[model samples]
Structures are given as structure tokens and as C-alpha cells.
Target: MPGKPNPVARLFWTAAIGCPFGLWYGPPAFAATGLALTLVLMRHLGRPRRFRARVRRIARAHAETLALRRRQESFSDAYGNRIEDGWLRERAYFLDRTVLPQIGPRFADLAESERNRMLAIVEAEAAAVALPEEDEAPGDGIDYERYCAERLARAGWRAHRTPPSGDQGADIVAVRDGLRLIVQCKRLAKPVGNAAVQEAAAALRYWAGDRAAVVSNAGFTPAARRLAAATGVLLLHHDALDDIDLAGAHRS
Candidate 1:
């Protein structure tokens, strides 16, 4: 009756809605019919290879994103460690990344000395507030490296601790009197040895600086003195500070 109630249409509607309900029940007919229809529709909509390719592309993109994030995190960790080390070399390396990028490409063409000048201004502007107290006893000869930095700064030079990995013997670097100089400071109570002079000479060669100097509270040994003279390394005795202005130079 009623033209058999359009059996195909009735079955289609039943399978469409009833398949979900069949999940809870035991109606294999509704599920099978719906699954078969879905497959037919997908086959007509697109080629299987195309769909598979799209899925593969998405997977590859996700992998690349993950790899990039990992690399960034690793770089961040290394940078943090370098800063925490509190070495001049470490600081330079970190600043090269964070500070250099902002000044743009013009800096790339500058020589090492010129580049250092630009960096000094930037570093000075961001100078940190020192702690309230001094760490060492008064007049107990300053750490030679720190002492040189203080002295040069007083002389209106921009001084910074340089990396010591292959330093050759230079402990500090400074720009002074329109010249860039590499300095080796010795805090011994006695005269420095010729070996130290050799080290300073090596450092000068390594840095290719305009000049090199050796500063020691303890005067230079005869051998050291001879080498310094022969090699053109400026020598400064500990008592030399009495003759120079050290207002901004490091103390304690």
C-alpha cells in the first residue's frame, strides 16, 4: 500500500540516522548501509591518492615545526649559560646576537675596532648597577684583569673583558688614546717573568691590535723587561697609578 512507501528512500533515511543509534544497539544493517554509502560518496568526491598526499603534507609540516621549536630552545639554553658564566668572552658572544642585530647591516662592514666602539656605546647605555659592597680587602692589589679595565675606563677608554680561550696572554682589552690596545695584568708582588712577556707578544699577534701593554704591581724581571722593550710592549708598574687619574677606574 502507498506504493510500498518508496523502499529505497526509506532505507536511505533510516541508515543515515539509524547508524549512530545502531552503534548502541545490534543493527548491522543500518551501519553497513551507511558505511557503504559514505565510501561511495568519498570515492566520487576525490581521488584516494590526492587525499593521502594532503595528509602526508600536513604530517611533514608538523614535523618541521616541531624541529624548529627544539632548535630555538637549545639556542636559548646555551645563551643563558654563556651569560651566567660572567666571563668577558662569554658576554661578547651573547651580545653579538642580541645587540648586533638591532644596529643593522652597516655594522657588518666595520673593522673589529670600529665594531667594538659601536658595541661599547650600546653596552654603556645598558650598564648594570653594581652591588653595594666591595668583595675584596682594601689595598690587597686588585685582580689584575679587573684593574686594567678600571684603569683604561678612567682614561676615557672603553674597556671590556675579552674571551680568553685563545688569549695568548692578554687578560683585558681597551680602546685608549685613539688606539686599540691589548693588556696583560699581573698582580704579583715580585717582578714578572720573560714568559709573561712572550705571552703578551703572542696575544698582540693573535689580536692584531695597534699596541700591546703589560701592567704589573710587581715590576718586570730583567728578562721580561728586555723582551717587552724588544717587542714594543708598554710596561706599567703598580705604583704608576699614583701618576694617573683613576676616578672612574675600578677600585677594590
Candidate 2:
């Protein structure tokens, strides 16, 4: 397709065409030509600004997509086998292969400040997806449940600890965007077992929740992970709670 007309070139052509008519005719002709030129100028005046705004919106949307991909990849790795420096390597590869190629050309016309601002937006989004540093477990399982609830609350979920004794299998119940998540929290030295996964899955049905998850300070046993996969129960590190997508969990 042919490219759009250059504003400067269009202005020059308009003036070139109108000048002779104005000279050949009288004041009325001159007034009409000037009005036409003004209208043309007004039409193109905001084109660059609008184009830049569109580019910024595209950049932000791509940044958000990259963040989501990173979170999903991290979640998968944490579930199965976590590799050292995996996230850093994955992020570098994504920026080099995906983000730069897609957004780089669109940014060519943007001013330095605007370009920098978009880059900052991308970095901020990526940082948000980076998992929180591991923290010491809370004093007891109840404290850990409360801690997870607080973390979920910060992430926009209305989360609270379930009642102690007869709360079924759910240690925490969180609701967000009309999705209810039943979580079984385990503060353990050993890997969480199949029982936790079983409880979380059962709790989801018993509590009429949209999704179920088992959050733990320790890793999950292979059997528990398999059971969770079969039951559509999320096996998450407590640190991963902030990045959970309630809708995605429900679908899973």
C-alpha cells in the first residue's frame, strides 16, 4: 500500500496550487484559497500526535502480554522443575526476539522522552511479574494462611482466613472479579503431599468455589502435583499468589 502523504509536502503542494489562482483572481479568490489552506493544515495538525498515542497504546498492550507470558512460564517452571537463572534467560530472549522486533519500528517516530516512558512501562510490567523473593514461613499454618491472604488482598482479591476447626479443607477463601478461590495453605519442611491436593480439590466443590489452589512454603510431592493436575487444582508457591489469574485458574 502507498504510504500516507507527508504533512509538509501536502502543505507545499496546496500553497503551490492556490497561489496562482489567488494572483489571477481578486481578494475573494485569495480569501477562498487561504481558507482552503487553513482547513488542510487543520486536518493534518494532530496526525503525528495521534500516531504517537497509538504507538504508545500498542507498546503498553504488548508489554502486558509479555508480562503474562512470563508469569505463566514461571508458574510452569515452579510447578515442575525450576532451573537456575531461568527467568532471566527467558526474559532476555523474549525482549530480544519478541518485544524489540514488534515495538522497535513503531517507536521510530516518537520523541526520546516518549520512547523512554514506554520502555519504563515495559520494565515496570516485567518487574511486577517477577516472583517475590522467598521469605521465611510464618510461625504456624494459620499465620501462613493469613500471610497468603494478605498477599492475595494486595493483588486485588478479597481474601480472608477460614474458620479454624470445621472449615472443611479450605484454609483461605478469596473472591475477586466474581471468582471464588479455595486455597489450602501448608507451611511445611517436607514437600506437600497428595492429601493437601485432595483437600483443596474437595474444598472447591464443597465451598462452591470457582477455583482451587494449594499454596505452600515447600514444594509439592510428585504425586500431589499429578493429582493437582488431574483435579484442576493449582499447586502454587505462596510467593506466586500475587500473580494468579483467577479467570485463568477457573478455566484450568
Candidate 3:
């Protein structure tokens, strides 16, 4: 036989089940206590969500949570690629996963200057890496020269590729703020040497330009760096050529 119900449970069951029926036929006290307790417990546990609309309403209120989900989307929009694990990819991911959560929906509520400062960190970190290699760059000389010109133009310098012949030694001529710059582009797999810098210095004079620079897709040798410094020519490696700020030079 099943064990007899305990006294406490027996009384609880009496109060719980009898309370409702008591209104119709059971004793007043049982009905009153049972019905009251059942209602109270139901309220405490809360009713099951009545419909999907309630869920939709809750999701709409969490705008910060929604914005954070766009991290990969923002990365793709800016960089033309998906997010991944590495210095270049993870740098922006860290900011998005960590700092942006704290800023949340109130991000736009902050003062303009503070917002710009915070976002500048993200944008710069997003752009700091991911330069293409020389082997990955265009093979054609004219195409490579055009590529360099386009890269400088994007970096806020007005750059144009020089004519194939009788263009002095520079491949690109960039001007900003009345300053003419003779740019020597050495698009080779080998690291650039002092020879490129020397050429830039000569081209600076030959082109009657106020400034000179040597840009290469491979990077500069130590000798090239030293000679560039001595000759007052700016030496830009492949990475620097793409990401360097020419607007600062324009201001100077």
C-alpha cells in the first residue's frame, strides 16, 4: 500500500483543493485557504508568457545588446573581410566585445569630443594592419604605380603618377597645400636600399619639388633609412605607404 500522506501535506492538500470547491459545497475555511494560497503561489511563479509578442517587446528594449551583435558586420563593412583571430582582427574585436558593452545605448548620449576620441581608437586599431605583400601586389609596373598613387590619395594627399618617360626619377608627384612632393616608388620584392633614397633626393632637385619621399612595397634597408634621414627624404615602407597620415605634413 502507498504510505499515508503526512499531516502537513494532508492539511495543505485539504486547504489547496478544498478551498475552491468549498465555495460551491465544501466548508468555508478549506475553500477560502486553498483558493487563496493557490492564487498566491501562481502569482509568485508568474504566468507563462502569453504570446510571442511579449518576447518581441523585451528584445526591443535591449538596444545595447543588439548593437554589440553587429561587431562582425561593422568589421566587414570597414575592412572588406570577416572578423578573425589575430593581431589585426582581434584588436577591434577586443574594443567591441569589451568597451562597447560598457558604453552601450548611451554611446551617442556622450559629448561629441569624447565619442570621437573613443571611436578614433577603434578606427585606428581596425586599420593598423592588413597591408598586401609585394607578391600579392599588382605585377604590372604601370598598375603598381597607379596603386601607389591611389593609396596616397586615400591617405589625404593629392597624388598623380608621372609620365612613363622624361618624368625625372619619381614615379608619383603628390601636392598638398602648395608643397610639391617628388615620390620615388620602388616596387620590388627586395628591401629598398640607399639607392632609392638617393634617387628621391636627386628627383627632389630635378623636379624642383619642395619635398621628397621614397616609397617601396618591400620595406627599407637600414642604410636607406639613415640616408633618407641625412638627405631629408621621407622613407615609407609598404605598410607606411598605405596607412601614413599625409594630412599632418600638409598642415606643416
lDDT of 1 by residue, 1-252 (tens): 321223356557756777776676766855676777676556534533443343334334334322322221121121333221112332354346544454344333332444454334333333332323422312333455776677667767788877757667888777656667777877653556888778878888887777777776445555776677677776664334323332222211
Candidate 2 off by > 4 Å: 1-134, 247-252
Q: After superposition, how far is residue 72 of candidate 1 from its true place, in Å?
A: 52
Could you tell me which residue pairs clash in candidate 3?
15-34, 19-31
Point out the higher-scoring one by TM-score: 1 or 3.
3
Model 2: which residue pairs collide?
Answer: none
On a 0 to 100 scale, what is the lDDT of residue 206 in model 1? Answer: 86
How high is the lDDT of residue 57 in model 1? 41
* TM-score: model 1 vs. ground truth: 0.39
Per-residue lDDT of model 3, residues 41-127, tens digit only: 664334222112232333334423333322212222133444322222333444455554544443323323343444444444444
Worst 10 residues of 1 by lDDT: 69-78
lDDT of 2 at 159: 94
lDDT of each: 0.53, 0.69, 0.57
Per-residue lDDT value at 28 in model 2: 81
Clashing pairs in 1: 150-250
Runs of candidate 1 exceeding 4 Å displacement: 1-142, 239-252
Off by over 4 Å in 3: 1-136, 242-252
Best by lDDT: 2
Clashes (N, CA, C under 3 Å) per candidate? 1, 0, 2
Candidate numbers, best lDDT first, in rank order: 2, 3, 1
